[model samples]
Structures are given as structure tokens and as C-alpha cells.
Target chain A: MKSAAIAPGDVTRYGLGLAAPLALVFAVFFIAPLAQLFYLSLHNDAVATVWGLGQYVKFLTDPFSLSVLGATLLLGAEVTLLCLVLGYPIAWLHQRAGHWLQTVIILIVLLPLLTSVVVRTFAWIVILGRQGIINSTLQSLGLISTPLRMLYTQGGLVVALAQVQMPLMVLPLITAIGRIDTNLADASASLGAGHWRTFFRVILPLSMPGIIAGCTLTYAAAITAFITQSLVGGGQMLFMPMYLYQQASTLQNWPFAAAISIIFLVAVLAIVALFSTLGRRARINGDAT
Target chain B: MMIDRRRLLTSALTLGAMHAFPGLSYADARPLVFATFTGSWEEAHKAVLVPAFRKASGDAPVVLDPMLSVDQIAKVNAAKSNPPIDVMLHDPGPALVAIGQDLVEPFPVENSAYYKDLIPEAQDPNGPAPFFQVVGLTYNPDTVKTPPTSWADLWNPDYKGRVGITNLNSTLGTGWLVEVARMHGGSEANVDAGFKALEALKPNLAAVAANPGALATLYQQGQIDISPGNFNAIQILKARGVPVEFVAPKEGAIAFKTTIHIVKNSPNKELAFKLIEAALSPEVQTTLTEPPYLIVPTNAKVAMTGEIAKVLAKDTDELKKKFVFQDWKTINQQRASWIEKFNRDIKI
Candidate 1:
């Protein structure tokens, strides 16, 4: 066989061949529909025959639309924060657990995702209802005279959404924490750094990519979660997805729905961007130190 | 340049939607897709209506695709060119929208046999209603000592935390708003009175379930004693061994007409018409109005002997007199806003 050095053009050709399928798939599935949604957003009617930014203008100007957007952001942020605060320790434990124990722990974390969201929401309703298990147990224990109203409350909805989204947060954190070189943590501890100090300085900083991934995924899912929010919040939550459904299906206003969808997409993208920028700045600051 | 881009994107999106719809290009003896309810309604159609339809149409095959009315309408809206749905079974609320959007083909009166026998209210320009879902007070007889007579009784302090109301997305929900509006001295033209009345009932309201299944759960669990629900739903619950009773309130109840419309550009228009005829047939109407489904038949000729006749509205004129029917086209225009206000105000 003749010895041949691969040229730059050959390498470029190989790379393009490797990327072609993915590029085609992305164009077919993602970019095309996204463009279509944007186009649909511009029109003032359902048929898409009418062409203008009237629907977008209306959505932007409507107080109801604005409030729904606010609620969506609030819910997404709250769920993401809750997941981070609760998931970190769980992920840390899973990272440190024995092989069999880690498998069991991972299964527990993923069990909720395996179950139907509707089923889970309904279970929450049963657990949190006035005459539910909690109330019954409390009453039996003589904790209070009156049954506490937990179902249909904002707090109750947060609990349900957080429960469903916890797995998403935990799995990413586990991956990030597992990837962390334990030797660095051991080095920090050997150098007389305490547990909390080593974790804050070494472990958490190393897990930034995972944190960002988990938060982005959880927040995005939480914002768009229609069934859990509607069932748990009892249609009183008025989140963006529910509002979009009302606009699209109930009112038969496809244009308004498209506008709201775009707004939701932009809001989510902005949050993700903000997180990425903050992470980058923090990493730069850490490098300087 | 921008206009061309817009047109191109628009065309691409429109083309994309053609793929979004379920496959309609199929070869069958009776190639038709009928969209209606799931569970018992679907079962009833399969066991009773489908066979009756086959016999009525000389053994033409029919396919029943079960979905909620809202979803069916959405499917139609998404695929305007050729919706996979050939026959749509929906409430008058969505039917009106379908008509306004020109998504439905007008009933072929020349093709229908029992179209004239249908009640005048059912004989809509959009489509004839095969059955009626009368919105009345449903209560567990075991829980409540007093039998509530009027819609205003929902506001009574004794029934506090016992009454159930549907959220604004449902037909019963909007109907409740309209009914309350009229009760509180507001007409269809202005439902400001409706919102106020609804807000007033907030304290008494035990649950604001979005669908029949949820409402039924509330009743089954004894979380609710009374609520405004449909006649069919109440009967279905009763059949399931729930101790429930239906009453057409003294102030009158809301009657939602469940219409069957033929989709425009459906390949099975002839078969669809034949199926509609079978649905409106006396035997089929009786089957629909009987035990499991318990829907009120719209066929004027369908003689109800044992149980259904006692529950059904007296006549089409009586239905008009007793229940408030709003122009759904007008109602739809404000539906999104009304739902928003409803969600905001009616905090259960």
C-alpha cells in the first residue's frame, strides 16, 4: 500500500459527510417547524392567510398575556431553584454510594419520570385534598380541628411540579459530580480545607456544566408542563401553556397561540443565555483567583 | 425580499401541517374517520351504533377515532385543507366555530332521511345535533337532605364547600357563566354580571374541575355534594353506582347541543351522511339515550318509553324556553378573555 498523507480538503470532505445527516435532520424537524411557528405568529387569524404582526402586537399589549408570561417565568425559576437546592445533596450521595445502592437510588430518582404525569398529579390531588390522606392523618392525630386546604393552592402546585422535575435535576448533577476528580477534593481536604469548604471551592465549581444543564432542562420542562399545572393548579394557575391552549383551542385563535409560544420560547432562551453568561463569568473569576 | 421570505415560510409551514395530520389516504370499503368521546361513549358506539350504522348503510365499514371535542376542533383547525376527521361529534360551541371557520360542510339535507324529524334546535345550519347534554344540577342524594330546586341555590350557605363547578374551558363551565349572568340580571350581550355571580359562588364551590372525569372523581370521593353537570354525565355516574340525582332547576338549566358535522373535503362524504342518518335513526337514538351513555336524543320521532323520556327536555321549544343558548360565534370571540377572567377570579 502506498503511504498517503490525508489532505485538508479530504478531512473537510469527511467532516461534511459526517455532519450532513444531522444537518438534514435538524432542518427537517427543528428549523422548519420553528420557522413555521414564527410565520404563524405574525398572522392575525387561524388560517394563516392573513399576514401581519397584529397577533404578536396584541399578545405583547395584553395584560393577561403579560401576567401569564410572568407566572410561567416564576414557576420555571421556582422549580429550577427547588430542584437545585434539593437535588445537590441527593446527587452527592448517589455519587458516593456503593454500586448496588447507587442503582437503587437512581431508580428512585427516575421512578417519577417513568410514571404518567397525569397519574402523578392526580396522586398529588388525593394526597393534598381536604379529605385526603394528609388531612385524615392529621385529624386522627388531633393535630388540628379543621382540615387544611392544600389542593388548588400555589404552594401545592409548586410541590407537585418540583416532585416531577426533581429527577431531571438530579440525573444531570449525578453525571457532573461523577465526572469530578475525587483526587482534587482529597487534595483540598489534605491541605486542611473542611468538608463544606472543599465542596464549595472544588466540587460545586467542577459541577457547573451539570448544574446549568439540569437547571435549563428542568426550567424549560416546568414552564411548558400543561397537564400537571392544570390538574394540580386546577386551571387557576393561568400559566403560559394553559393560556396558549385557551387561545388556540377554546377561542380558536391560532395566531395568538403562536405569538404566546414564541414569547415563551424567547423567555426560556433568555434565561438559558443568562445562566450561560453567569457561569462563564464565574469560571473566568475562578481562573483569575 | 421579506415578503417573499414570509410567503415561503408560510407555504413551508402549511406544507408541514399536511404531514402533522393523521394519514387520511387509506383504502377501505367505508374509509371514514369519526371523532367523538372515549371510554363508554366509544364502547357504546362500537357495540350499538356501529352495528346499527352498518345495517343501516348496508354493511359499510366505519372507523371511530375517539377524542375530546376541543382536540377534534384543534385537529380540524391544524389541517384545514383535508382534516383526517370525516365525521365530527362535538358540542354546539365548537360546531359554531367550525361553521364560522368554514371547516365543516353543511349537512346535505337532500342526502339525509331523518333530518326533518330532528328538533329545530338540532337542525343547525352547521350540522344537526344527534343528542343533547342538558346542563342541570347534579347532587348525591345520600349527602344532601334538601333537594335544590334553583340554580341560585348554588349560592346558598348550607351548600358551601359542597357545590362543584367546572372550570371555564368546558361547555358546562361557560354555560354556568351564561346562566349565572342571566340569573344575576345580565344577558348574553354583556356577561359582566356572570363574572360577578361566579365570584360570589367561589366560597361555596368545592371544586372547579375542567372535565367530566375530574368532576366525577370529586363526586365519587364525596368531596362534593352538588354541582352543575350534564344530564348524561350524572346518569353515567349513577350507573356506576354513585348515589346521584339530576334535576332541571326551576330557574331552568343549560342545554348543550352535541352536533355531528361532516368535515369539508373528506373523501367519505357519502358514507359520512349515511352514518349521520344511522345516528339519527330511532333505534340508534334510543341506544344513545339509554343506560351507559344516557344522552338526550334529538330525534323527534325516537319514542322514549322507560327512563330517558323522564329526564330529557320536553321539546325543542321547551329547551329554548328553559335553557339559555348564546350565539357561540360571539361567545367564542370573548371565550379566551372570559376564561382568563374566570381563572383569575374563581379561585377554588
Candidate 2:
């Protein structure tokens, strides 16, 4: 016997029941504040602020904001690329190797993530600082006359971002690649494709979706990250979050901070779109079978 | 029926929001969440300010949010309308900014006579917030054998690479700069020669420390020797047996002052008012000047002897003659440009 179809009125009632509470919570916490943010972004609320596009225009035109947006994109891309380059190797090794080897690899990647961000960043600082382990080692080994300036540099940012986001890249890639049939790779090899050819033509193409997904996640996280960037950059690293924090707090310019946030949101979405487009093209070229 | 539903929801919303807020009278009794820069204020609030506030309000505890000055400014700005910090202990610059932006309300003076207790510099014409000075040089005695007699000696070649200086952005840094300027026959009016002198000492300098305590700790472990830092930091460090020495240099030690202004749109105005009063009360100010950390007292009533320092210049008169303090407001106004130039000019 078939169950009776749900009535339109019942569906409406059910939808309203869920939507109303969600709308209420969002309205109170997220939406209302966001509405205020919109207002702030548009107008000066300082002297009983009236709505104008001055703040938005200011944010759009600001050189510092542009540089921050640029840096954010670059850092995000670097982190994602690093995750792809480094993560795939670890993930592949884990898949091929025995359970004990896989455990060791898993532990190694997860170790930094398991630690607090603050602790991890501090560890990096210690390793990268002038008087830190890296410098001391370099000095003891007679690598150079003076200590190398490694910390508070973009290179440092990439290293840290890569380390932090590597797990993000690895876990997903592993999940996707591990699920791929081992027989397909073997068959491709038997059909005379070299190991390198097999990796590029078969495995790499198959793992594109996972790679894209992982890269997108990493880029978003790395770009928006505040604490790691700030610590590593030494307050001089003028990232978007740092700039946003300063404008809102130091300058007492809420409108400016909101406007900057809007800019950040736009940039992050643009990056995700750019990468996802690449993923879409890859999906199209790869064929349904 | 539609009208009834809308009206019911509207009424419910209004009531719900209102219920979240305190009733008008007891609103003043709500806990005033306050913050001060970490260091001496930590001990002062924990050991003294908290217990007294608890005693006064019975249930309205002052939540202590400790922070660095820069971080404090950032956090307060983040939570302005709905401020997590109801009251903050800010230095002259931020206090000035707070007053300028109307972020803080004026203090309510119950008695005009009691207001006379503030030093000439502490008096502010515009707001209820007054200045607090932690005068005297903060240094580690164990690191320095002679215990630096003058500001000139801080630039000595022996103490190079072990000397800690304040960030050029802060009053403490400018204080060191101004003293060196006067020593090299320059005035606060022209800080060029002084900045040059400071730049000259840069090769020997350690990192520009964020707080006096950091400098003191480095100095305590014999990692650093000179930290021409804060007054209270020296006191707190000495109290903790860090072997830190506080004295006036011959060119006059720079006196750094910070003003405390009540926040304008505070949830606990009455309690905030009371806390300020109690903070400035004799009971509170005295503890800030106890043995080992015997800081100079602003209150005419709080007794501070000249015998506080155990070094080169033992007496207060001799100390005052040597380390003359500059006008803070004058220095604070021009700090942004000066610090920017200093950062560009100095290597460390």
C-alpha cells in the first residue's frame, strides 16, 4: 500500500516551522548585525552617521587594502599549491605503505594540527627566530658569518601556512585517491604508460576533484587567517585582517573595517571562483566514464 | 486575527529584548568589566583591586581583562557599542583618543576638595579621567655593577647588545630619547640630536620590548642589562626578587602618565563610578607603593621616602635634580611622526 502524498499545506507548515526558528536565530545574531555592517560600510556612524558610499569608495580606493588583498591571494595560493605538492606525496606513501608506515605518516601530518595554533606558531617562531634552534644550528655548523633573516618574511608565511594546511590537503586527497581502483593504475601501466605517465594521466586527473576541494579549503583558511599571519609578519605584515583590526579599533572606524571586510569577502569569493572554474574545466575534460 | 498575531509577536519580541537587559535601578550595580595593561596592574588588581571591589559591591565583581596597551585598544574598539570592557586603564595617548572620540564619559566628582589631590599634570580640563605616573627608571641591578648613575651610562659600550629599550611608539621610549637629547645638549623642542644619540646606541641594543616586565625578566636572567622601562614594572619586578633597580638619571628620568576615563555607554555606570573612586582611594594607592616596589606616591597623603632606591643616587631630591621629567602631553602629540621616523632611522 502506498502512503498518502503530503499536502501542500503540510509542507508549508513544516517549512515555516524550521524556517521561522532559523530565521529568528539568524535575524538576532547574524542578519541584524550584518545589516548594521552594511549600514556602517556605506555611511559614517560616528557623528550620527548618515548612509553614503564614502566608506565603500574609500575601501575600494585604499592602496593598503589592495596590497592586503593581493598578499592574501598570494599567500592563499601558495598554501594551496604547497598542500598539493607536498600532500599528494605523503598521501600516496600512506596508501601504498603498510599500516604501521601509514600510522607514522598520519601521525606526522596530524601532529601540528593536533597542537594549538598558538603553540604551533610559537614553535615556528622559536625555530625561525634569530636566537632560535634554526639559527643556532646554522651558526654551529658554520653556514654563514651572521644569523640569517628567516622569520617575519613571506617565505616564513608560506612555510607556516603550508605546515598548517598540509593536513587539510592530505586527508581529503587520501580519501579520494584511496577510493580509486588500484587495478586502473596497474592496467594503465600494463598498457605501456610509464609510472610518471600513469600518475599524470590516470591518478592525477582522477584526484582533481579532491585536489580542487582541498586547495579551495586551504586557500580560504590561509587567506583569512589572522593569528598566524600577524605573529609571523610582526605587525608589519599589513594583511587584510590586520588592517581591518586596526581600522576598527585603533582608528575607531567601524565603517572602514566593515568595508574592508566586504573587500575581503569579495576577494576570497573571487579566488574560490577562479579555482572552482579550473576544477569545472578539469571535470568537463575528464569524461563521464 | 492577523493583527492579533502580529501584535502578540511584537509584544513578545519587545519583552524578550527588555528581559535580557537589567532593570533601570540595578543596572548601575552590574559588574563593570575592566582591563589594564598586564604587569604591575596584574598583581595590583588580583591582590588588591578585586578584593576591595568585591567588598564594596558585594556581588558586582570587576572582571579583570589583562592585556598589552595596543591589544587593549584593539579589543575595546572591536567591542565598542557592546563593550566587553566597561572601564579600562589607558595611557595618555589612548585616553586622549578616547576623550576625542567621546568613547568615555567624564568622572563624577563627589567632592571638589578631594580632586585637589591630583598632581598638576594629572588634572584634565575636559574629562573626569585623571593621569597616573609611574616615575623612575626600571633596570636590573644584578646585570649592572655600577647601577647606572645617569641616562648617559645606559649608552655605555659595556652594556651594548644587552640593553633593552621601549618601542619608539611609547612614552617610556620617548622618555629615554628626551633624556639623552638633553644630555647631548638638545631640548625636547629639537629631538634630532637625541634621536641620533638613540640611533648611535642601536647596534648595542636588544629588541624593542613590548612591556617593562619582559625587559625585567630578560634582565633578571642576565640576558639583558638595561631596560629604561616603566616605574611600576620596576617595582613589581623588585618585589618578586628579580633584582631590578629603579633610579633617576642625571638628565632626569622621563615620567610616563596614563589617564583612566569611564566609558561613555557603559552598562554599569554607577558601579564604574564607584570603582574609579575606590581605585583612587588612599587604601588602593598605598598598596601600589609598598616595600621593595616603593613607587613614588601622587597622593599627598601617601608617604614615599627618598630611601626607596638602593643605588648610585640614594636620595629623592638628588634623584629629582638629576632626572627631570618632561611634559607628557607635548610628547604624546608628536609621537606618531617621531616614532615613524625613529623606526625608519633606527636599525634595531
Candidate 3:
């Protein structure tokens, strides 16, 4: 079964057969539309659009657009950080728990994903509204005379987004943690490292790939999310995707929308690239140790 | 002659790709794609109008794609060569944008019999106006002891922390802004007065709902007691037992005209025109003006009576005297900048 034993023609046939379907899909679905999107981004107008970079220039120089970009990045980063903090423990428990418990926990984590984003957001509104359960309970307890504003705030937005994106973070981290040999943690303990020390020194560094994967997925989802942000944020908290939708659809400024979309895509990619580089460094350092 | 296997495979794949687009295979009898609102609106059409159109047109296949008007405009513009939407039902704001971008074609009003039957205002230069909506003061009678009589009454201190307003994306929002501007001695040309008025009202505002559905939800939850909304939404809520009232503010109401435009370069142009004609027919108009849809008809032939008549303007003169239709083209142009300022300027 050695590769060197196989004929060159057979190897070529096997490779092509294995890759043909995916390569075809990428060509038709991903690469083709992406190329069209880039082309549209460079255009000057909607109908009979001519090739130019005026739309890109306008987006880069506009203060409002710059602020939107900042908000999108900030939301994405906060949500990703929150997801990691909340997801790590659940993922750890998922890995160490009994088989039946693991199944139950995994199902619980995946429950939100089963429901529509719109439904989940509406549920959050019922929980977080002015006269909602939380405020009513607080009022009865004489905690405060007035209802505290929770819904439509940035904090509310982040909380809802983090909850929706939690499962994405946890699943990947679970896979990464599962791949780590339990012996390493045991060995670290036997070698006189405390639980926290062993986790930081061994488990954390080895799970860098999972951390990068989970963070990137969650960050991308939160950043591009429109419905949750629109419904929960009440259109007051502006995000890049919302602005892009307005430009593309409401205003019918296709060139400008295309330009914003391109920039947003690049920004997400840049963040992912940075994490991937860090992941590579962590892997190299772990291997050396 | 050796058969190059790679070359043969490539050719086969390309042919397969070409075959994927079966929609283009038929030159005639393809289902005409018609785009409009979702939920009850779509249901109303399906229950009455679609079947009537089908019977009249010898059972032509029609595909209904339910989408927001903004989305329909975007989809058409994106696919300029062969747009998915053959015809669209949209408000004047989006219709004006569609006309400006050349996404839609001008209606042939001179030749159509239905054109003569429409109220003069409904005969838009861009397209046929199938319906009209009154965007006015909407409130819950159960919550507000004194029903609002004027737009200025929303600024009352008693209504503080209990008011909602539609976001700038909707015609209802823009219509309210125009009225606010006019009331404050500034026209749509100068909306600064409106912004100032809106800023003052922000303390009272509980939510600024982005879409009609969200606004209705806010009303249902009792989060807001007062809002500037349209007759159709109020009718829907009232029918659903929300105990809401649609008041034509004493100052006057702003009319939002709804039009059905045939998309430019549509593959099914002939069928699209028939669908528009069918939608404007007296039978269809009657169905739309009743019960759940509760839309006001632009067809002069379709008479309104009972509660619907009392709320809706009876004639073109009454419409002109009582309701104001803004310069929608100018409004569409200024919408993006206005939205940016509104979002930044107001607290809610």
C-alpha cells in the first residue's frame, strides 16, 4: 500500500477522482461568485456599471463607515471572548463526563441552533423587556422601583449573540480537547504541577488549534449577523452588515454595498489569519517543549 | 486516434453545468415570477386573486416569491439581464428607486382601460398605483385614555416612556418625518425642524422598530402605547384583537401609494403585465380592501363602504385635501444620509 508502489497514472486518477466534486463545487459556487462580487465592488454604478474603485474609496474615507467598521469589529471581538470564557468549561466537562451525560450536555448545547434565530431573539425580548419576568421579579422583591433598561442595549445584544454563538465555540473546543491525550494532564500532575498550572502549561497550549477554530467561527457569525442584531438591538445599535444591507437593498447602491461587503470580508479574514499564525506558533512551541 | 480522457471529462462537466439551468430551456409557458409581501398579504392573494387570475388567463403558471419590497429591488438590480422577479408590489419609496435605477419599466397607461378607472393620483408616471395607505397616528385605546388627535399630541409629557416610532427605512417613518417638518414650519426640503422635534420626543420613545412586524410585536407586548403607523397595520392588529385604533391626525394624514411595476427586461413580460392587470381588477381590489388585507384601493371603480370607507379617503379630491404624498424620488435620494443622522442624533 506504499505510494511509491503505485503507478503515476493511477495516482493522478485517484487524486482527480477524490478532488473532482469539491473542486467543481468550489469553482461554481465559491470562486465564480467571489470573482463577480469583487468585480461589482470595483464598479461605479448599479446599472451599466463601469469598472472603477470609487465605491471602495468612498467607503474608506467616510467617517460613518469607519465607525460602522469599528462597531462590527468590537461586537465580534467581545462576543468571541465571551464565548471562549463561557464555552471552555462546558467543552471540558463534555470531554470528561460519562457517555450518557456527554450526550445530554451535547444535545443541550445544540438546542438553540435547532430553533430559528428570529424565534430565539423574540424569546430573548420576552425575557429582557421592560415588564418581562426578570424586571417583574426584581420589582416584587423591592430591588428597584423602576424597570432597568435591558433590551436593545449593547450589553443585551452581546448577551444574546454570545448565547447563539456558544455552541459553535464549544463543539470545536470539545473536538480539540478530546484529541488531547488524558495522559499528558495526568503526567503534568504527577510531575508536581497544580491543576491550574497543568491546564495553562499543557492543556491550553495544545488546544490552540481548537481555540482558533472556535473563535474564528463565532466571531464571523456574530459580525455578519443581522436579524438578531436588528430585532434585539432595535435598529439603534448599527452594525456593518445592517449598513451594508441598507446600501445594497434599501438605497439600491449596489456598488457601495459590494464595496462594503468586500471590506468586511477582508477584515474577518485578517482576524482569522492573525489567530492562525498564533496557533501555528503555539503548535511549534508545544512540539519543542 | 487516442481519446484524451481529461479533455473528454472536461467537456462532459461543462455540458452538465449548462444542463443545470433548466429554467432557460423553455422559451414559452415558464411560470411568471411575481414578488410581493409575505404572511397574510400573500395568503389573501392566494385565497382570492391568484385563482381568479388563473381562471381568466387560461390557467397560466404563476410563481409567487414573497419578499420585502427592498429585497425585490435589490435582487432585480443584481440580476439586470434576467431578473428573478418579473413583477413586484412595492411602496412609492422603493418603486421610485426601482424606476431611477431602471430596474422597472414604465406602465403603458395611455392604452390600458384600467388606467382611466384609476384615481388621477394613482396614475403614476412610473407605474400603476394599485393601492394607497394612510400613515397616521396609531394608538391602543385601552392604554391611552385620551386618543391622540394631532401629531403634536405625541410630544405630550404624559406619553413619555410609552411611545414607539418606525425606523427611517419604512415609508411610515419618512411620512411621519415629512408631517413633523411641515407642522414645525419646515418642509421636507428642510427636515432640521423634524429632527429637533424627534430629539425632543426621544425621552418618551420606548423603541424604534425597524420593520412593520417588529412594530406590531412591540404593540402586542404593550411595550409602546403610541406610534405613527399605517392603516393596514392598524387594521391587522385590530382584527387580531389588539384593541388598536387608527386616527387620521387633525393636521392631516400622509398617503403612501403602493404600486406594482413590471421589472425591466423580464423574461415573462407579457405574463407580468397580465398579473398587474389582474391585481388592479375590481374583484382583486375588493378582496384586498376587505378584512385582513384592509388595503385602500386606487381603482376608482372599487368603492369603499362601512368602517373601511370611514377611515379611507373617498375620492381623489378628498385624498389630495386630507393626505399629503411626498416627493418620493427626493426622499429616496436623501434616505441614506437622513438615516445616518437620525441614528446618530436620536437617543432611541
Candidate 4:
């Protein structure tokens, strides 16, 4: 009935007009690059060979491939865990703080996120270096006479990644936490549930969606991250992307690199899909949207 | 609010960095890009090594993109026509691969006085390429409690978490493998025992460093105890006030050579050779051994060097007895197999 007053074709035209820009962008950046990569992976040197998936097979079977994949997954999981552990408190703090304090806390939370990955990674290098502030301070405090080895370890990589990815976790959880009414906490307190108990029983059940979203986002990012991992992990990290980088550049095996990348993508997608299924089930059980 | 510019400096220095890194440099300024891949090696070249080449030749410089030695040739090969490259400096490993692909034309300016009397390995046996570069260890005298004369000193307990290494896939890894094999236990030919020897020194590892600026900074700060740094890199390190010592191992590092060649499509073809000819000249090569760019010159007669420049003299007469030179012929023939084996063996 209302369709008589409205122009019928306008909806499709407007929807298409809005989507046109994004489609063009997708075609240009995503589709074009993928096609070029596929083309490259098929060729031996400059000339095209039969478009076979030989490159993928080479990368998959190589023993080094497993090490890199394991490393990437380890780093990704470490980053995600750190984000959830650290980011939750900061998100809660922001949600509960007074208006100006919350604004300031939010701004502080966003600062690392705003800075480029390279800048943050460089900062880590400077701070974690043997003569860097941490070592310098510890030495001055008479904590240790020598600078502890900190810069190029797995711990150093964790700190750098966690710092860079914290905001990704915090922002979403804050939004979810903010939506929870104080009435629920008040009600829980009246029923004799303590702060920690209420936090576990009341607040957490409500924030699961944000937690899931944040984990997914940060996990995905950490998996593909090359620049930060390279800088912060300091060649100690045997990451899959780094292996892919070596294959394309040093080994000159584009096909092999492509194959490894395909395997990685498949593995990552499978893991993410599996995680999301578990998250969806949890959401259903918790009665949270 | 009194904003202090000097306070900014104080804060930055306190924070352990002042300005952004001096933008990482490359060799040529022209369209001809040469990725050096060995990060510290590139930093040394751009900062200390290539400057002399530029000054002596007066040719427009090309960007010297530093890379991991293991991967530079692959990336270059990947970008053959739309090559982000025109010239590159590589050791025998990739040079073998490059030759297999016909990536180079015959290097024209090779009949130099120094090249004529090269220590066998410099001349490319399978092809017409000029031998140009060498690799070895550089140490800071202040950092090392006991200075090393051979590869065995690297496995010292004191150096646990002290030493740095370059890209594991490069000649640095291969050279270290070969040297340790010869000195420690294994034969000069097959390095099974050599690879195992390096395993003992694993704990003392600082970082498998690839970035030249990072290595230079570390060396300057005395963070590195014993690390793989090249001759030109050490020269650059010393100039930066890092108290460095050059260690031409009793068994000299298998003197890996980087052949300079002209590209088929290099626009500055005449300019390129003139620059090459100029670079190969005794005077230019002599000049290279001094001041900013402290390379061991390709010229035998030109013995000029800076006060800090360590002349890498081979016990030329005792090559068979002392050194384990890489047979270019053998390496060239088994090139692909060597690379595959290096991968399967090191599994990096």
C-alpha cells in the first residue's frame, strides 16, 4: 500500500549507487591483487606454466611451514589473550568512571591504536634495547648490575603486540559493558553477591559478544601482521607470513609462497569459523545478544 | 606554557632515541635500484661504503635497498622487468642463481690489475662476472672480554645471548657453517658436522639481525659482543665511535665475492661502466680503503687504508693449508642442490 507513494525503483538504484564505490574498491585492491598473485604463482619465472597448485603443495609439505604456522598461531593467541586480560579492566574502568575521567581514559586507550604500527614497534625497540630505559632504570635502581636480555625474545614480542592490539579489545568491550544497566549490579549486591561474584555472574555474561568480537578482530590482525612482528619479534619469531615473505623474496618461489599462503588462509578461516561457532553457542547459552 | 625544544631533545635522548632513524639508504640515486638485503651491510654501504664509490665516480647514486641475503635475489628475480632494481651486490650463492637465470651480462670492466691476481674464488668460472666484495667478522674491543681469532670463540659461554647474526639464509650462515666445520671438526667439503657445531653456539644468540641500522646502533651502544658484520660495515661502525676491531679469522672467512655487472637495460650504460671503471681503478679502490667507505680494495698494489681500516691480508701463500676457499666451480654446478640442502638442513 505504502509502495504507491514511494518510487519503486529508487530503493534498488540508491542501494546500488551506495554499493558501487565499495565494489569498485574491492575490484581494484582485493580482486586485482588476488588475480595478479594467482597469475604469478602459476608462472615459472616470467613465463606462465600450467596453472597448477604445485606451489601450494610445495609450501604445505615443507617442514619449515609447520614451524612458521605454529609460531604465527602462538603469537596470535598470545596477543588475543593479553588483549582480553588487560583490555577488560581498562574497558570496565572507562565504563564506570566519571564523564571527564572516562573521556580521558578512552583517549589514553586510543593513543597506541592511533600511532602507526611501525612507530609503536620502533618505540618497543628503543625501550627494550639493552641500554634502553627499562635496563637503564633497573641498573640505576641497583635491581641488576647488567641489562636483562629483553628485546628480541618471545616475551618482547608479546608486549609489543599486546600494546598495539589492546585498543581493539578495549573499545568493543567498553561499548558492551556500557550497555549493561547499574540496576543489575545493585540487584546482585542486594542478593549478597560480592564484587568479584557479581562481575563473573552479572557483568561478564552481558559482555561476551564484545569479548568475542574483540578476540576475532585482534586474532585476525595478529595472524597476518608482518611489519610489527618483524620489528618487535626481531627475527626470533618464525612466523608464517615471514616464511611467505622469504619464499617470495629469497627463495624466489612465488608459486610455493602462494601455496603456503593458501594453506594459511584455509587454516585461519577454519579456526575462526570454529571459534565463531563456539562463541555463537556460548551466546545462545548465556542469553546475551 | 613554556614549550622547550631542548626539552624535546632531552626527552628523546632519555627515551633512548632522538630523531627518526636517518632514513635507511641505498646505493644509487638513479632509477637503478639495488637492494643490498643484508640490512647492516646496506647501512654500511649507503653510509660508509657507497659514498666513496659515488665521490670517486661522480655518478648519480642509485638506491641501495638492503635485504636479507637469502631472499634478495629471489625478490629481484620476481621483479625482473618492473624490477625495483638495476644493480645489486650479492655473494656467491645468489650470484650463482642469477647467472643461471642470465640476469647479468658480461661485466666489462673486470680486467683490473687487482682482478688479474685475485685469490682464485673472485673470478666467476661458469660465466663472465667480476669479483667485487668480501665478508668477515667485526667485534667491539670494549665488549669482548676475550677477542676471537677463529669461529670457536663464538660458542663462548660469555657470549650466550651476546652475539648477533645476519639472515640465516644468506652467505653469512653458509660462511659461518663452513668456517666452524673446518675449524671445529667437519671437513671443508660437506658441512654436516659444521651445522651441528653451530648448534652448540645457539644459546649465546642475541638476534638473527638483518637490519644494518639496527646492527650499527647495537654495535655503537656496545650491545653486540661478537656478531657477523662485514668489513665495510665495521669501518662504518668505527666511524660512528663504536670501538670496533676487525677479525680476519686465522682461517679467513671464505672470501665471498659480489660481481659488479651492467644490466641489459640500464639507461646509464655508458655512465654505469664509467662508474664501474672508476670504481675498479687503483686510485678509487685505494681511496675506498680509507675514510668513510673502508672496503678492502680489489686492487692488490693499492695498500692505502685508514688508521682504523683493517687490511684483510690473506696468508696468500698458505691458502691450501690455512683457508677453505669455496670452489666456485663446484658451488656453481651444485648451486640449486646446495640451496635446497641449505633449506632442508637449516630448515630456517
Which candidate has the top score in DockQ? Answer: 3
CA lDDT, every model vs. true structure: 0.80, 0.67, 0.83, 0.65
Error of 3 at B336 (Å): 2.9
Candidate 1: tens digits of C-alpha lDDT, residues A17-115: 999999999999999999988988988777678889988788789886788799889988988899899999999998889999999999999999898
lDDT of 4 at B55: 72
Docking class of 4: incorrect
DockQ of 4: 0.16
Estimate, for each residue in A172-192, the C-alpha lDDT of model 3 and write its tens digit. 999999888999999999999
Give fnat, all candidates: 0.33, 0.00, 0.43, 0.25
Quote the lDDT for B178 in model 1.
80
User: How many clashing residue pairs appear in each of the predictions shown?
Assistant: 0, 7, 1, 21
The superposed Cα distance between candidate 3 and the true structure at residue B250, in angstroms, equals 1.8
Could you arrange the candidates by lDDT from highest to lowest? 3, 1, 2, 4
Candidate 1, B1-348: lDDT as tens digits: 467888999988866866675442233224678887887778878887789878877877678999977788778877988788999998767877777778888888876778888877778756888877788888889978788898888899988777887778888788778878888897666699988887788788777776656776677766678988877777777877888988888877777788899898877888888888888888898877666667677888766644555654555555556665556666766776787777667666
Report the number of the highest-lDDT candidate: 3
Candidate 3 stretches with Cα past 4 Å from truth are A1-16, A45-50, A287-289, B1-27, B74-85, B264-271, B313-320
Docking class of 1: acceptable
Give the residue spans of candidate 4 off by over 4 A: A1-19, A38-64, A113-119, A122-152, A178-202, A227-237, B1-88, B109-134, B157-161, B184-189, B203-224, B265-268, B282-287, B307-348
TM-score for chain B in model 3: 0.88
What is the Cα-based lDDT of residue A100 in candidate 1? 97
| Candidate with more favorable, higher DockQ: 1 or 3 | 3
Fnat score for model 1: 0.33
Q: Tell me the TM-score of each prediction against the true structure.
A: 0.87, 0.74, 0.89, 0.75
